[model samples]
Target: MKFLKYLLIFLAVIIVIIAILAFVAPTEVKVSRSITIDAPRETVWEYVNSLEDMHQWSPWAEKDPDMKLEYRGTEGKVGSVYSWDGDPETVGKGEQEITSIQAPSRIESELRFLTPYESKADAYVQLDETGSGSTRVTYGFESVSPRPMNVLNLFMNMDEMVGPDFEAAMSNLKKLVESGGSSGETQSEMAFR
Candidate 1:
C-alpha cells in the first residue's frame, strides 16, 4: 500500500512537469534543408515548380508507393494542386496548392494535412545560382501550432523529424535534374530572373 501510494504520487509529478514544459514550448516550428545541384537555375526551377515532377523527387512519395493521388489545375501554374490520401500514420491525407511563384527564384505553397491530425503550413522552395553551373535549392516548411498543440513540441523534435525528408528530397531533386540531360531551354530561354 505504501509503494502504490508512492507510485501514484510519482506519476502525478511527472504529468505536471510535462504539462509545464508543453505550456512553455514554442508554438511555431520551421524546418529547412538545402542542397546544391549541378543543374541550371531555370532547369531546377522548372522541376520544382511543376507539381507533377514534385512527386518524382519528394521523399514522402517514396514512403507510400501505393498512395492515391489527385491533381487539379495546370501543372506549374499558381492554383495548381496535388492531393494525396494514404496511411494515416505515415503519409496521411493532405493537399498542397501552389499559392505563389517567382519563376526560377522562389515558389510558395499552402500545405494542408487533413488526417491523422489536421494542420496547415506554408511550404517553400528557393533557388539561387551558386556559380560554376550549380544551383542551390532550399526547401522548407513553416507551421504555427495552436496553443493546445504547442505541447506536442515538447515531446516532438520537429527539425529532427522533418529535416531528413527535406534533405532526401533535395538530394533526389539534384539527381533527377543533373542526370536527365538538359531541359532543351537555352540560356536565354531559361532565364527567369
Candidate 2:
C-alpha cells in the first residue's frame, strides 16, 4: 500500500513537470541547412524550383524509391503542389505546395503532413550567387506546434531530427548541379513575373 501511494505521488509529480515543460517549450521549430553548389544561381534554382526534380535530390525520396507521387498546378510556380505517399515512419505522407517564388533567388512553400501526424510547415529555399560559378543555397522549414503538442519538442530535438535530412538533400543537390545534371537552359524560361 505504501509503495502504491509513493508510485502515485511520483507519477503525479512527473505529470506536473511535463505539463510545466510543455507550457515553457518553444512553439515554433525551424531547421535549416545550406550548401554551396558549384553552379550558377539560375542553374541551381531551376532544379530546386521544379517539383519533379525533387526526386533527384530529396532525402525523403531517397528513402522510398517507389513512393507514389502526384503533381498538380504549374510546376515551379506558385500553387504547384506535390503529394507523396510512402512507407516507413520517415516518409509517411505529405503534400508540399509552392506558395511563393522569386525567380532565381527564393521559393517559399507550404508543407502539409497528413499521415503519421498532421502538421503544417512553411518551407523555403534561398539562392545566392557566391561567385562566377558558385551558388549558395539555403533550404529550411518552420512549423508552429499548438499548445501541449509543442511540448513534445522538449523531449525531441526537431533540429537534430530534420537537420541531417536537410544536409543530405543539400549534398545531393550540390552533386546534381555540379555534375551538369541540371540544365541551365530552362532557367530563363521558368523565371516568373
Candidate 3:
C-alpha cells in the first residue's frame, strides 16, 4: 500500500512539473534560411512565385521522387493550393496555399501538414536585390503551438530540423536560375506583366 501511494505521489509531481513547463515553453517557432543567387530579383521571383517551379528544386521531392502531387486554382496566384503525398516516413503529406504575393519582393503561403501529424504553418519567400544582377532569397516558415502542445516546442529545434533542407533547396534554386533554366513564366508572372 505504501509503494502504491508513493507511486501515485510521484506521478502527480511529474504531471505538475510538465504542466508548469508547458506554460513556460514558447508557443511559436520560426525557421528561416537565406541564399544569394547570381540572378536578378525578377528572375528569382519567377521561380519562387510558382509552386510548380519551386517544386522543381525541392529537396523533399528529391527525397521521394515518386511523391504524388496535386494543384488547385491558378498556378501561382493567391488562393492556389499545392498538395503532396509522399513517403510517410520521410516527406509525409501536406498542402500549401498561396496567401499573398508582393510582386518581386515577397510571397506568403499557409502550409498544412495532414499526415505524421496535423499542423499549420505560415511559409514565405522574400527576395531582395543585392546588386545590379544579384538577389538574396530568404525562405522560412512559422508555426504556433497552442496550450499544452506548446510543451513539444521545448524538445523541437525547428531551425536545426528544417535548416538543411532549406539550404539545399536554395542551392538548387541558385543553380537553376544561374543556368538560365527557368521552366518559363507562370500564369501569375504573365498576369503581373
lDDT for 21 in candidate 1 is: 70
TM-score of every model versus the real structure: 0.82, 0.85, 0.91
Candidate 1: which stretches are off by over 4 Å?
1-23, 181-193
- Residue pairs that clash (backbone atoms under 3 angstroms), model 3: none
Whole-model lDDT, model 2:
0.84
Among all candidates shown, the one with the greatest TM-score: 3
- Write down the TM-score for model 3: 0.91
Model 1 scores what on Cα lDDT?
A: 0.84
lDDT of 3 by residue, 151-179 (tens): 98889888898899999988878877876
RMSDs, each prediction? 6.2, 5.6, 5.0
lDDT (Cα, tens digit) per residue for candidate 2, span 1-193: 9999999999999989878987899999999999988877877887877677765678887788679999999987799999999984769999999999898899899999999888899998899998768899999999998878888888899889889999998987787777666443232232231
- Score residue 40 of candidate 1 by CA lDDT: 80
Say which candidate scores most in lDDT: 3
* lDDT, model 2, position 181: 67
Task: Tell how far residue 110 is off in model 1, in angstroms.
Answer: 0.7
Report the number of clashing residue pairs per model.
Answer: 0, 0, 0
Evaluated at residue 96, the lDDT of candidate 1 is 97
